[model samples]
Target chain A: MTLSADGSRAGRSPRRGLSMRAGRRLWLAIFLAPAVVLFAAFVTYPILSALAYSLYSWEGIGRSGFAGVGNFIRLFTTFPYPRLLANAFGNNVIVFVLTMLVQNLTGLGLALLLARNPWGARAYRAIFFLPVTLSLVIVGFLWALFLNPVFGVVNKTLGIVGLGALARPWLGEPGIALVTLTLINAWRWLGFPTIVFLAGINAVPEDYLEAARLDGASEWDVTRRIIFPLLAPAVTIIVILTFIGSFNWFELPYVVQGVSGAPNRATDVLGLLFYRTAFGEVDTGLQDIGVGSAIAVLMFIMLVTVSTVGAVFLRRREVEMG
Target chain B: MRRLCTAMIAVALLATFFPASVLGQEPAKLSFWSWRTEDKWVYDRMIRLFQQRNPGIKIEFIPFRAPEYATILSTGLTAGRGPDIIHLRAYGGLETFAAPGFIAPLDFEQVPELKRFPLQTIAGARSRKDGRIYGVPFATQTLVIFYNKKIFAQHNLTVPKTWEQFITVMRTLKDKGVVPLANGGKEGWTLEVLSGVIAPNFYGGTTFFEAVTRGQTTFRESAYTGALAKMLELRPYMPTGFMGVDYATMQQMFINEQAAMFIGGSWEIGFFKAQNKNLDFGVFPGPTERADQIPWVSSYADGNYGINAKTANMEAALKFIRFTATLEFGQMFTDLLAQMSAVPGVVVKNPQLQQVQAMNRKATPYIMLVGFRWQAPTGSTLLQSALQGMMAGTLTPAQVGEEVTRGLSSWVDAFRGR
Candidate 1:
């Protein structure tokens, strides 16, 4: 409800105070120009530029003849051979699934316990949120050091506990590298979902819970009947954020495994591949920009589609809670 | 008032036009980019000395983390913006800088002091595209096996000359409850280092490499097969679950004597000395199967510097490159960085390096970015993946050979297709 200069409703004074309104328009333009310019420069420009590059075959920063969808063709046409595109997409899915199962559930469990006022819950919250403040690179590096087979605390501790035989390379093996990275990512970001869920649980009307408890409801029953349903909105947000993050995952894997995604590219993610194809590596010396741009376009489309669908599906489950 | 305003505007325009001249003979500032964080002192000393010798020029030093340097530099260059001078990796990395005109060719006549460096020592500094030397070569490194002399003595082992002898020595060390090798497998670079030492000896050195480049030979050939087989032979002697160990941990293992030998480049010597001053370590060329085969030591040019072609400070950049060859800079590098200078007359501070110098006749190309630049996965990637597979037991020597051969053929096809 916008007020006019006459102190009337908007429609009554739509054409009133023209000079002053012009001044107001000028001020609005002045205020918004910086943000508008920034959005155009940083976000809109790069996305448009990537879309443009996807149409052509370029080596990027060098001679670029029109390849015209050859990059896309190569990915789709690798029939008899294993498509790197499929492998990378599959890896992202695995990360997303594992994270949703392990990290989210863990976060929810922690949030529920904290809401129940467990012993030293405040201290435990701080401890849990500690890793969130750290940069992903630092987390990756510290985790890599711990997972190192030689002179690493993890393996050494395992040895001290007489589980020396169980001490194996956590990050180097193909069967476990992706899972390890997912777990590390979960460890770093678990606090976000945990806090969100906790906030949602707090916002749930205590009157409903109290009434249920007076009716001889268990704490678990109150939580299931009232608190959990109210947290649907938080669940929707977490699911969408997790989906986006899983596809865009790069830094941790890169810091730990390097650009090659070594041990036979066992840890190769789409982000790493996109970087390698676009810029090349110190060793490869061949930058295929066309393929890299194609990958970027695919990643953007996939992330948007999945996140939108996920949000829509999750939003449908969000009860009115009235 | 009008006259005064006009006079002030005139002075301001003049000031903008001639800032340096107005400021009483200020030095011409040049920006220098480097990633050697720990050895910042070496560059600081070099800059001070260079500044003293050339008083008219001042260089602003900017340091970045080495792992991120390549990406940052590439982005800067692509943006048509960068520092005046940059530190580049040797061989294939330098080629990209030179090939696409990111680095300008140096005027050799202006800096003839660079002649002190052996052409082969800085061969990696020469660009593959233009066949021109892009910058001054500062440091030299050779990859060799550094073994614990105390451990060798305890096991009553001698340096092996043949494959059987090497196997026997490894067996003796393994049976004595010592980790036989300390090679990091997590990053894939150490495996590359391992390939560098063994591949040249078995593959007829440079001759076979040239043939393979010309498409007359494939990696599936017996030379690569045999070398790769030998690569597999040494895997069992490593610590259990060695495939996941990284360089730092491997270094720790060697320092603690948990591992009897560390197969790394000369860069680790300083770290080794720092960790255990009394540690008795000896450098040896890696062992081979045939007694008659001369083992090849992997040599690379270090601290390779290049000038940005579009820089505003050409004269200052040239002076910097020239100063890299001076005895003063060489000594500073050798003393502070604990690495050898390829500048001919530089003093060798570490006596252990002298042992490596004696085996120079057996020196070979540090095989990376050499044979695989023409294809998709790349030569370094091919070898790294092959080595990783061999270690994991997922790939046999024959399978490794096939993988490399496939990469080579792809390169050949792409080359021909292009």
Candidate 2:
């Protein structure tokens, strides 16, 4: 029973089936060597040590010499580092276009009002996913003490409902501090795009929404012409995770604006200028680490070339709207 | 009993992995560290009174998190591992660990009370590229103002020495409704400590900090843009959206009296008498444009006590950093941290720390943390983001003195090629 005499002499000699296809290619390189050595020790060794510490000139942690690209030509010709890198890349493109228009129109109007399962729809989907389970340092320290422009309870409930001339200083206005931190990061990621658009509206095909509601259609034309074009793979997984969480925003504007993104820096971003240039912040006095490894290698080549060209142009609009 | 519970779990894993070689000759412990996480219960009661005056030593302490304690103490002393007494910071945060040797210089024979401090508070722990003295100088602070005194004795008011009687006593305590500047601007270093308490009486203090650290005259001079236009003329006596008032809501609007004055820093007098034990308050120092000028204040040197040059208990961390420069640990660190103790004679016994040690004898150098915080665009981070863009009007006290002489001419050889 030697494996049926070596599987009938390895199907009549193809050099004994090339040693059984080199013993199944050495068990597929020993089952892909520990996820390719843990993705090259935690993602290609910290992006090639932040591209070799963005060409030298360190200081605190010492490296001192080489400065070839000279900290990316002083982070784009210095003077407040090119106006704080174009005001932190224009506040990360206004926190990714106002957190993608306030989290896709309030996450597709709360997934079309919680896909009709009215009253306690699983306790209103765990109370709209309870601020994505709290801790962004307790939602930026309870929204910087409930937007404290004087003992805050939101300007004393807009001065007890009279609206007190629209209580302003909501984050000390520098043209409304990055739209009040993109509406508090779309109120803490609008329940992750309302549970991915209520599982893309309960997987849409109820006989193609009852043949477009027996052809009478209009529930806003079966929600804007067929469940918003079949919720194109949950809007391309929330537009490539809101373009990599709006350029990795950094701990709720560093726990409600402190790393110098205050009133003037108007909610600065490139993750609080790469954590005040690689962690120096006693109100940004020292740490350079060669311009924080050239702002972490220009934010990893702008979030991998705009989220891989917006995830291949939104996966070709989810295969031409599936 | 199951072989005596496996021989007492191998002598409790050999005393939890050789805690100093399982006590054969224990006591050299050391460690320390600090950032003051609220002075760890007065440094664990001053390390148990320096471990009962050094009975074969044993310290420990630790602390941290004061804004991630200078990047976790320079990444734990650049990974050579840390603590054997450290707590540094004064002057360019102690020349970022005494110009990289990671501290350990001191002299007068291993810190003989760094010869009783004051050479400008031991030049804030020295080391400007090896001038030496690594660390010891501990508390100084100053700044000034404070006020309240039961809202200036129920608004009868007085102290205003000059700046037009301090803008008519903050316009009669802002027409009596009060909040006469509990200072704010959502903490860009408390608007650089309110431009070091109103820019050293319109930037002429110590003759503009020795002509702006000898590059002859810089912060775009008109006496430092008339002290950033007297901090935008104390922006309508402060509080109302004082740029979204922060430093813990400007110390909870001056310990809840709803703000009568504040300015800040004599380490907020033991956190306003431990947050209001009948909060009266007093202090002063800022107003001078004329009542015979000598006002000044703006002090500095608020840190030190170093050692760790990879300290394997260097003689119990130099006898616990020379018992933190003596005078009985500077009168128990100015009677438990009300502060001022850069240790000279140390006999304040707190009458408001003896008027902050007599207005720190007309002090001066808080100018961007003493001579432009050493390097890379610092001058206290370009005057705390140009005084938070001149208190958010989006800048102009001559553009916060031309944005702090163009970020200290990118590295101050007296504002280089300005």
Candidate 3:
């Protein structure tokens, strides 16, 4: 009797109140619907499908039979899986480390130089940002030709300078192939971080830098203490993005190396290894898609773990600088 | 509210199921996707001819360039939206497409001309374990040693008949400041021309390849290592920085007369003739060790067309396959693409093609190198890496052999587990 009285009391209120609440809810649903649907359809569905597939022995076709954890186990005991994974992971780490170091150092240095109001600073920024616009495929093919040991301009120029001895086959030698690939990647991606840092630096309040100067802080001291701290968010973003990009690096090595990650598979990364495993080779039989999916899942897990750890560390360092 | 929910559910179900029902009433139009954009004109003409021959059939030709094709095909296949017909290259992952039964096996009676295709080429299209032909072999290509006639004439060197003579010619050419052979190891497959094809002859001959395939001999014990040793031996004769030169640039070097010989496939005949019409070049077998042992040529189906197993218009698909296999269609396609036709008795009128045709006929049965076969997904990569390592002095021949053996064994194990 008390609940009925409460319900009647609520129902007797103005219809406008209920309609208003309903309208608000409708707007909220409308605003969130597109993104929710897109996320579910593309990202979530594919991930779930891949996870499901990792447990099967299908070749990406017909009936998929359940293999349970057989695919994962094969990663350890199967032919050269251990060695291939180690080589690929090792190469990926090397690429990630080198790309991060080079991109950060070069990008920050360029940002600092541009912040000094040098002549044609805008033009310099434009020039530095140009390569990032190019597709990695184009970048890779361009560099492949540019670094050609026989007739490439690099070697020809070196030969002209009487330093012919210095010009080795950059992409051919196993020791240097990975380094060369890293350098190419850095060159292509340097523009993005530089632009990001430049934006961050521009947002730095001038008064703080002036106060630092007035306090007898040298230019280096001002940059080190003030500008650097202020730019932490940008640095965090760049590092995280670079790390992910390096881990997923596929096109440059694939196009330049022609899918073999050549020079003794010196350039092999997990991306290439995954592709070969799924596709099989001329002498070997075709791969099971189930195993390929399992490898992909493992790669995803690794990426997520690394990204999480990186986010935690970087987020902790990001503090608002007055 | 209940009525609204029921109505919405009805609409959703109708929307989803309507198209499939509608599809059943219409003539199925199949889409044929291919990566051979270079042969677009030829395919277009062939498709036109096919449509005319089969009035009820329709084929939409979708072409893609490299890398993109792989991505697009993978996406389509995964989404169950792949084309009915797909043209596959020799090297990329054919096994992946075939093993899962994504591709339909060609009906032999519908396309009996396939019987005329080389046995090795047909064998390449079959699953190693099941021996089911999943692709229709349409074309074949082989890598032969092309010698600069002018260089040979100037040096008074007969096309070296034996390996010893070949080495002697190289020494003579080296003495004259000309690189003996222009090979690009940068992309790595250039090394295969030496290792996969030429080296087998030096190691164990035809028996060696058979043994490797049968698992009687691993890649390590086979003549492949000897081939690597031989490649290392000739490293001194190759142009400095040859490691960075790609196939095109290497061919360019030969065309410019900067190099004496180019080891490459017959596909280059068209490009070479276009660049220098007057350039005198002759195709010769790779030098051999024994006098009685004829030089074996390496060849495989360049690309094969296969039907998607999910395709609805099986009859139309079979008609298209039959149309392409006809001698007239085969000749026209080959003539336009400047490739050797898989159809027997299809005479190529072009002189350059005639030469290739003659070579194809006279050469010992072409050996299907594992590099071209769909065996291990990573086999080519492994071999390419080992070769690159050997060339860079970072790996020994023994190590190269061991690495390949280990990689292949692991690949085999992975598949077996699956």
Candidate 4:
């Protein structure tokens, strides 16, 4: 027997290597098949189809003909569409900004409080996270009733507190409707970030605090300079997820304000616009799937670009802190 | 075990190949779909009546939410997997289905009762492109002011006959701390209906509608803007914080007797009675600008029943749709639904429904729906938003006119010249 490379016999080496390669190939295929198939079917296929559909004029489900960039042009130049598209995009930006601000501050504050392991800390955590578990439909519908001008509990509570002067229609005013919707959305999702931040705080090593204390650092100083920086990963996740959620928001607003985002389109969002365009308005009963697809493609590009850039920036910060 | 499995497979294959006719046991079932979920019980009663007359066919009535119905129906029809019979919306709503041949076309020969309906009424179910009637016209909804009889009696206010008297009545109601109008700005469609009740009286009704359609005038004309201005004049008499009030709330206000009047469709009669058995209300044509002016209400054909083009049970579907066109179905609809039936010669026994029919005689087409719903940037959409802005104090009446004119001008050649 002749040794090959190391101590293996030359005759046996070729057969063993060949079988090992074949076995590894089979195992790789087995492991990757489901994920690859799913990604192609759900992700790649939809994106490509939407891109293709955007370039054509569609009458309901039937493709009328290729229109090149006609659909996109219509979105930008059409009398009401340009106005609607801008309003929706601007509302999404507002939703993202307000949601991020409200979630982070409240979440971080709650996390810090719970980090002390106060009496019934687990119960408090459960209470804070409870809203996240409720169905968005129920939450939206309940909130709509609560905010009603005459019968709503919100206005009733204000009356009881003698703040009756401030009891205006929360969702009826065009100026404040989008803001009201965002705050409701924030209330629904506040629990998720609070739990994430709490976990991050708990994972902080106790020895670091002890060392900081030994050096005569105040609790506030230790938290500001130490624990805060260590929670970077959690913040990154919460921020990115909130951004995506805000842009893709549909159900809660749809349930509360409807597809028109009533009160003169005050609460219109990209998602609602997409749906109205695709399915036709309840009153007019005319649908333009080509324009709807165009809106979808634009939204997708925006989401992907912003999210990727944000993740890279956040991940870099995480690495720096680590 | 292998022999048992083989035997089971053989039985299943044989069952699939055996026709119901061969078995001479089961009736042929035809599925029906509609957006009138609220009317499902009534439809079930109607379907039972049809089943009694025709024992060999069983019909299934399925209803979906109004907002989701169009999408659901389109998706099902596209996949060649929808119901055999369909309840379709009229005008542009019917055209979307009919233009693509998703609905089977009907002829006067197939259903001779189609000749009973006037051309204008039949136009609602006719395909704009193909010029073929595709469905049986079902009902007509007229816009009118519904007044709480008790409140009007308490205030000694008979229905006003002119614009000046109407304002005086509203003012009196406001002074008495009653919401004069139960309408709101929260829902654009409700606002459109509110406009429909008030606008035509100022804009010369069918005459102006014809002129605009013929490209002789546009929405920017004073007659149209003046009508919008009239709507603004009633802002003070509307419910408190009316901008936040929705259709349900508006209905609640009227039903609860918090508001004295409601501008809504005639279809509200059934809903009002159902919600509040003790409620007493009466309908009136919207007051005119002058005592002599025609009190023109906006009216349109509401919906229709059609056969799905790809139905396997075509014979049964046609039979049922024909039943819908008969005077019997029309009377049942008018009595149960409390709206005007499109079927001619059907006596409306209900007093409230009779009043709606009387008011509809002076009706102009619900202009936006009849003339402008065929294309994108629809006139209804433009008018709704404009009216909302006007109510919100963001836009003046002329601006509302201009906005609507601008939107319609994009597709309407009549407005394009200016």
Candidate 5:
């Protein structure tokens, strides 16, 4: 009787334990179900479908014939393919560098200046951030109009200032077009970063600044060592966001230059090229869908890779101030 | 889990219920998509008239802007939710849509007035390989030289009939501190007309269109090279910051009397007139050196309406198209929009259009260069880019030609591979 009782106790304990575990798992699954399903439907399915599409000669309509790696092969050899890729990558890198250097530097400087509670600081913030809130399309069109050589305010003002020689076509010359576009891009985005950096600057305890000032530290030194270090998180966020935005850039160039990326194809970016390849233009017939898909896949891979690298490297520099 | 289940049930129920009556309907509502917002008044009137004429048929008008139209159309077709009829601008990529069976072939016998339209217009609408009519003939437009009469009178110059005279007149205007040509090299189409059409037609005589269409002659050997050379020669006479100006800005220069002459299509007449009704302007054929060869005129159907393959109301869609083709609708629509009709009996009263009509009539023997008439997709961009490059000084005339050849050949190979 004692042996049977022991055996029954052991069996009941394990069985009860198993049932409890099962119940816990069910609860966990129930909690996670919505997110998993949403992610699967939105992200995973589209990516897998894109991958499948990358192997076929589909025109985004009707029966898509299978073409395997032929599309990828054609992308390298086709008309201006190599040049197009180079132009896109080079332009993107240049824009990214320029934005990081100019936009961030200018933004940080502005934040520092504004942190001093300069006159009309509130009005200044509103004016500076206004462009950021406007649509990129509207900004592009507005800039295109403003930069018009004949009647544009820029050239007209330059002429009025007796600097007519310096007022050349901003968006037309190949050497200057990308630089001009980058500057415009920086101008548009600077406000967002400036606001964030200003918030970061404000968050720095006033006592620390006062202590540094009392310790005979110059304003530059305080900014460089204390405030700047603390503002690293905002800087990192801005950099990552900027990197992704630059890599995925399309609308501005598209609206400004149209489909040909004209003025000698100076403004052709990867997004525009991908679209042209996929949709075909007046001159080029429809590009092989497989090849276009491959280009898209490459673009996706590039954006993901760059973003990941940027996030990891920049996040490491983010100082968690105790 | 419960939320997900509820959402799924809702989606399933909606999907099932929405499509049931749609599937059961006969003479279903046919949706016609167009990128003609500027002419919405005329289109709406026509649609109403069509509906009044055919009470059994229901038509839905889906209008989008030009840029968004292509994306929307492609998306809708791919998703199996495409409209019954679609308006397609004449461009090179039509074959891609036709090849995939996303476009349906039109039976011309149903609308026999197809014979009255220009053969080139019909040719552009037909699939090159299968010879199937996929689009209804609509309106035709051509590039014409638009010169400001006030500027011309100021410079004491008349509309030049010869290429040499045109250059001479332009030089004279330039000497007077007036910009000769209102051109935006930033917009590649202006560059295309300057290099691809004007240059080649004048220098190569009748062989320009032949060489391009046949794909045997390189752009280098054609008069197109001469055109580029001429453009280079005339570059000094153009307005400062010519490269920076866009189509609208350039047109505004001409309209505002900042520039003397503007080369553009007939489509701009209405816009220009609307902007400045009193601006004295005259239209003339693009100048040519060889008067005997007949001034080669370029004209093509601007846009055509086609029935979607997935249309639920094919008969109703055809009825709408037939109604749209009638003389009453065609004339009224074309007149209000200031466009030359594809329908034979529709008369356009605008003097500029009358000049274009006369030119089209006179140049009937000369081959009309329909830039849209290409079976391959890459030819248009190739032409545009090559011309643009030449105009921008990045590419020489010979190099531009080579690029066109290379682009076309590569496109051919790509299409064949597909």
Candidate 6:
């Protein structure tokens, strides 16, 4: 309350008002202290520590010394051999692109069908979403057994259906391993996008659809014209999320394919590459923390840069709710 | 009812927070870590015996999956909080731990039984830097072929002593619509085993590896490339999706009699017996490249026990290490664990392990991996990746040989720097 006595006092001596403002700021600082401290301890500290490690030449064991940019140089420029840093990055890109294409389209299709409220709609939704709830490790093992070329149900089923020729080592083939893993990733995450899209569709006012139908517009036309534009907010969120998730793909591949991204490193993504270099893998048998940190810093930069650009691009497409 | 619920909550909270202090008794304890998930019972039984022998010392046995153990153990050790006693994988792997001084060197007086161990057995756990033994040998395992005897008999096949005869047997088995060799190419170690078993014959066994280390020679020479070719040569006789088969899948195929032969370590015997007791299996040294040559098997001491240098419970750790060296421990290891003991005088009664023990005349250090043989641990990694590439038909044998040489060059540089 700006009472005449307070206003006149503030004008007479601004120090009185300044001290009050400082007292208010102190309480604000006190309120935010826990969150600020936690952020510094866990997130800020580790990132900065890893960044420091990237600047040194350190094996997991032994005395670490400064390497300047040597670790980064070796990671970026190692050649003649196929264990190049570029291979992992390229594989990560493929995983991202393939997952976006497969996951988004399938999810959208399922959401559209189910949003009609057909018979057993909730049951179908629940069934499709079941895989998302399973632990990645369990999913990996189940899929590994399912796709086992020798005794796998997939191969056995193929053989029974006179499609024996189509049966092959799905996980073992270098050509198809990454593609298969990306598809499996999409399958596992199908529920998230479906639910998001369904919510967006339902939020579209029924009056908008009814008016279109009364005006003789078909269901498909109404959906493309009215429902989709209103669902733009969810679309943007889903696209950005899919972009981030794809770049971070690790657990499913690591669990199913083992540490080496087996079948000749065909499924070797950047995350696996970083882990193998840093922690040491049974197959790679390397524990070069410096190189691993360098890989991580590089991946961090790429992820941030691409994620920011993706968010901006996706956000630009979002339409205002009418 | 509300007061009763509140009272119950208060009691639970008090118990959770102050139980240990209130109980007023704290036993001296030691924690042990190992990657032997399948052999957990053996360790539990040994721990029971250890606790019985030392009533005051409470030992906790923690097990990790084999592939994940190195990362978990190394990380814990780096944080200065690893277990008091660590079960280390023979030589090559323990070098990483030793390099950082995560493991402590044994005190000769504390474990006098160290004097009884052969220098060769002690050598596996010895630090390459200080030449001090950091751990005691627990057991030794060998890499060799385990074949289904009944299947071999059905095909009227005798054990092949030469590469040519071996190829004939593999081809015959393949022709008869049976998997001759259950190849688990998905794992690099298995491929390494197959290649290591064959590499020795052409490269003059362990002698050649030592000579290469002394000279710092590039493996680009055909001596190594030739062995890679031999590894590739058996691909036709392997399962259709040999690259897809994993360690477990291959084991099942072998046990089920779908496959006649499996190239693996003697460590597989316990698992094989438990999985299919009805299956008849036999052991053989990997065949030689030439008929006149003697086949060399890759043998290495396994399950070497090391102590955490930073451990507070050093006395208990020393006690555990010393006990592992005793004949009583050796007897228990063999009888209960079904493994060959490294305690010089003790032996395992398993016929296959005994056969392998008797065949030590042709045995050599499993050089490809054991840190003592390969200058860099990554030499095995390079070999694994190169072998995988070759199997995938992406690289030639000579290219793989070059990769191996290149990978070891870093180790050479490190040695020269020293």
The most accurate candidate by DockQ is: 4
Writing each residue's lDDT as its tens digit, candidate 1 over B288-383 gives: 658987777777676477899999889888888788868887787777767777778877767777777776677766655544553345677667
Please say which candidate is ahead in TM-score: 4 or 6.
Answer: 4
Q: What is the C-alpha lDDT of each candidate?
A: 0.78, 0.82, 0.75, 0.88, 0.74, 0.80
| Residue pair clashes in candidate 1 | none
Candidate 1 vs candidate 4: the lDDT winner is 4
Give the clashing pairs for model 2.
none
Query: In order, what fnat does every candidate score?
Result: 0.50, 0.54, 0.62, 0.49, 0.55, 0.44
- A-chain TM-score, model 3: 0.90
- Predicted candidate 6 versus true structure: per-residue lDDT over B43-162, tens digit per residue: 889889988988868888899887789888977888787999999865657767886788888868878988998876777787677778888899888888889999999989999999
Q: Candidate 5's residue-wise lDDT over A1-322, tens digit each?
A: 1235548666566767788789999999999999999999998897777777778876434447788876777777766676777888788888888988999889988988999999999999898899999999898888888888888899999999999999977988766887888888888988998899999999999999999999999989999999989998888888888888888888788887886666676877787777777655533344455666677888888888988887899888888876
User: Residue A173 CA error for candidate 4 (Å)?
Assistant: 0.7
Give the best candidate by lDDT: 4
Please compute and give the TM-score of the first chain of candidate 4 against the native first chain: 0.93
Tens digits of per-residue lDDT, candidate 5, B121-177, equal 776577665888778777787767888989899768988888778889999998898
Greater DockQ among 4 and 5 belongs to: 4
Per-residue CA lDDT of candidate 3, range A267-290, in tens? 989887777666443223345566
Ranking by DockQ: 4, 1, 6, 3, 5, 2
The local distance difference test score of model 5 is 0.74
TM-score of each: 0.88, 0.36, 0.86, 0.95, 0.87, 0.89
lDDT for model 6 comes to 0.80
Candidate 4: stretches off by over 4 Å: A1-14, A17-21, A320-322, B1-26
Best by TM-score: 4
What residue pairs are clashing in model 6?
B92-B370, B92-B371
**Residue A262's C-alpha lDDT in candidate 2?**
76
Per-residue lDDT of model 3, residues B1-418, tens digit only: 9999999999999888777537665455888898777667778888888778676677888898754676678678877889988876543356567766777877577678787876767765766546777777678887688889999999888888777888899999999988888887876667866665567567665676566656666767636677668777778788887777777788888999999988888878767877898788888777778667667666666667888888877878877877777888878867777788777667787765676666555343333344324444355556776788788887888888787777666545432321
